[model samples]
Target: MNEPAAPAAPETLEVPVAALRPSLEAVLMVADQPLDSVSLASVVGHPVETVVAALQLLAEEYDEQDRGFELRHVAGGWRYYTREAYAAVVEQLVLEGQQARLTQAALETLAVVAYQQPVSRARVSAVRGVNVDGVMRTLLTRGLVQEAGQDAETGANLYRTTRYFLERIGVSSLDELPELAPYLPEMDDLEDELERVGGLPRTPDAVQDHPAVEPMTDSQETP
Candidate 1:
C-alpha cells in the first residue's frame, strides 16, 4: 500500500504588525455573534496570548476614551455593546417602533421559564393559567429558551433559558437573578388565579399530588 500522504504544511500568514488591531476590528465589525479569543487569534494569525492582550488593551482604551460603545466579554466570547451609561440614547433610537419588543405575554412567559426551568410547557401553562405553546415557540425562535430534556415522568420536553438570555439580561449567571419569590402570590392565590383565568379546574388530587410549580422556590439552583 502507498505510504500515507505527508501532512499538508501549516498555512502561513504575514499580517503586518501595524494591521493587527485594525484587522481584528474589521472582522468583529461584521460578526453577528460574539467571537472567542481563539477564533480571533486564528483569524489574525497571532498567538492566542498576544491576541488576548491586544483585546484587553483595546477594551481599556475604549473605556478611557469614553467611547459610545465598549467591548464586552459575555457568554464566553467578546463583542461590542453600547455602554450602559448611554443606554437611554441608544434605546431612544432603537426602540422607535423599528425593532419589535417582546410582548407582555412573552415577557411573563419568559420570567416563568427563567425562574422555574428546566420546566415543561404544561407546567408553565398551569402556572400562567393559559396555553404557553405559542409563547414557548417565540422564545425558542428568539434564542432565549431552548429544549433541555424530557421530563422524567411526563416525557414532556423541558425548557431552559440560554446563555443568550443571560447576556441580554446583563447577568453573569442564573444565580444573579433577583429575589422576587417573596413578592409572588401564594400557592392558594395562584390556584385561584389559575382557575379564574381559564386553567384546568384542579381536582382534589391535583391540588394535593400534582407536581406543578411550587410557590417560587428559593432553593432551586441552576443545573
Candidate 2:
C-alpha cells in the first residue's frame, strides 16, 4: 500500500545510556587487582582520556569526602586502598581473622616460602623437618604463594611468595622482610640437606638469591 511505511524508520534504535562515573565505580568495586586505564576505557565504552579524567576526579572526590577508602595509582594501574587514618582498624580486623583462620603450621610454612623463595616443597619439608605438600597447597590456594619454576636437576616445582603476600604483610619488597630471614636455613644449607636426602644437586646459579621482581608498594602501607 503506502510502500510499507518506509520500514517504520527502524524505530530509532534506542540504546540506553550508561552513566560514566557510576559505571566506573561498579566495575572497580569487584576488581581484585588494579585495572589500567586502557582496559577500563574499553570496558566502560568511553575514550581513554575521558576514563582517566573520570578516575582522577573520583579519587579527588573520595579524598575530599574523607572516605574510608581511597583510589590510588599503583603497580601501573588503579586500585582502592584503606585510608591511612583507618589502617589500624583494618589491620586489627584482618590480623584477628588471619589468626583464627590460618593454622600454626600454615603460618610456619608461609614464612618458609617467603624467606626461601624459588625453593621447592621438598626443600621446605627438609627445612621444617616434615612434609609440606599439603601446607604448600593451602598457601597456593590462598594466593599467598605461586610456582616460580622447576628445579633444573630434580625437576621439582619451585615456589615463591606473591605480590599479594607482600601486601598482606605491609612490605613493598622482600628486602623489607624482618631480620629473621637471615636466621633461616641458607641456600647452601638447604642444598646440603637435599643432597643428604638423596635429591640431585642444583647448579650454583639455578635459583636467584632474591625475589625476581620486587613488589610495588601499596597505597596504605609501606615498610
Candidate 3:
C-alpha cells in the first residue's frame, strides 16, 4: 500500500533559512517600510529575541565598518537608511534639481498617507473633511505618494508614502517621523480615520490656519 508519500509534507511547512544578519539585510533592502523584530523573525524563521540581538549586532557592525548605509530603528520597526554623513552626496545624486518644499496641505496629506497608508483617496478626503482630489494629485505629481494597489472591498486605488518621502524627511523609517505617530489611527478603521482627520484644526475649508500647517519657504524645495 503506497501512501502517495504523505503529500510531500504540504507546502506551507517549508521555511527559508539563511545567516541571520544577511537575511535581515536582504529583507530590509526591499521593504517599503521598517519591520518589527517579530515580523523579521517570522520571515527569517528565528526567535524574536534572537532577531533583536542580531539587529543590534548588525547595527554595531555597520557603525564599525563605516558603511554608506546603516541599519536603523524607526516607526516601531527596523530598516536601513543612508548614513547622515553621506546624506550630502546622496542628496546631490538623487535629489539634484528637484527642490520644492512641501506646502502645509501637502504635508498634511503626506502625513495622512504615511500614517494610514494603503489608504484610498476617498478615505483621505473623508479624513481631511475636504475634497482631497486636487491635493492628492499634487502628492502624486511630487512623487511623495505612490499607488500601493487596490482595495479588495472597494476597488479604489490605495496610496502609500514613497521611499522618497522617507529620504526627504531624513527618517530611517516611518517610526522616526516622531513620537506623535502612535496617535495615528490604524490603517483599517475608517470611522476612526474620519474622526482623526476631523480632530485636526479645521477652517470650514480644511487647509487654512491649521497649527500643523507650517509656512512654506521661498525656495519651494520639492520635498
Candidate 4:
C-alpha cells in the first residue's frame, strides 16, 4: 500500500488588478514600513505597472476625498500617513489616549534626541541631567527614536529622531521644529550636566572632532 498522498500546498489568492485598491489599502494600513510597487505587485500577484497605477489611483482618491489619512509615496515606497491638516487632532487623541501618553522624561529625552541627534546616550543623559537609557528605550519602543550608529571615538550608540517623531510633532523638517531655545533645555544646563555626568565629550567641538556615520539632515531623512 502506498502512503497517503501529501497534502497540497495552499493556493495563493490572486487579487484582481481591477479590484486591488481596497486590498492594497488593507495591507498598506497594516504595514510597518513603506512598500514599493514591486513588492506590492508581488503581494497582489499583479504586474508592476498595474499595481503602480492602482496605488496612484488610491492616493488620488484619498486626496479627492480629503480623508484624514492619505496614501503617500515617500522614500521610494508607498505608505499611509495622517493628513497634515488633521495632525493636531490626531496628536491630541493619541496624547489623551491612555496607551500613548509620553511621560515628561520621555518627552525631554526625545527633544534632546531630536535636536542633538546622531547624539549618543551619554550626551542625551548629559543634556537631561539624568540617565536616559530607560527613556530612550521607551522612545525606541514608540518608534520615535532610532539608533543611527556608533560614535567614532567612544563607540557609543548614536540615536536620531525618526520621521514618525516629526509626524507626531507635525513638522515637515527639523527647521520646522518650534523655536528650540524655549522648549528644550538650555545650553548652559547641558554643559553643567555634561560636567557632572563626566563620560561623553564635554563640548560640541569635541564631539565634532571625531565622528562615525554622517548625521542626516531633515531634507535627507526619509519619512
Q: TM-scores for all candidates?
A: 0.46, 0.42, 0.42, 0.45
Candidate 3 vs. true structure, TM-score: 0.42
| TM-score winner | 1
Clash count in backbone of candidate 3: 10
Q: lDDT tens string, model 4, 1-223?
A: 9999999999764535458976787889768579998999899877998788778877888899999999999999999999999999987866664266787888887887888888987666655556666677768767898989887778887899988888888889988877766764676665555555544455777544533222222231111
Give per-residue lDDT, candidate 3, residue 31. Answer: 80
lDDT of 1 by residue, 1-223 (tens): 8999999999654434455779878888766469998999999889877777778878888999999999988887889888999999977865562346788888899999999899888777767766666677778767789999888877778899999899999999999999977979887776687655444455656653455542333232211
lDDT of 1: 0.77
The reply for model 2, stretches above 4 Å from the true place, is 1-18, 102-223
User: lDDT for model 4, on a 0 to 1 scale?
Assistant: 0.74
* Residue ranges of candidate 3 with Cα displaced over 4 Å: 1-18, 97-157, 160-223
Instruction: Give the Cα lDDT of each candidate.
Output: 0.77, 0.73, 0.71, 0.74
Off by over 4 Å in 4: 1-98, 182-190, 199-223
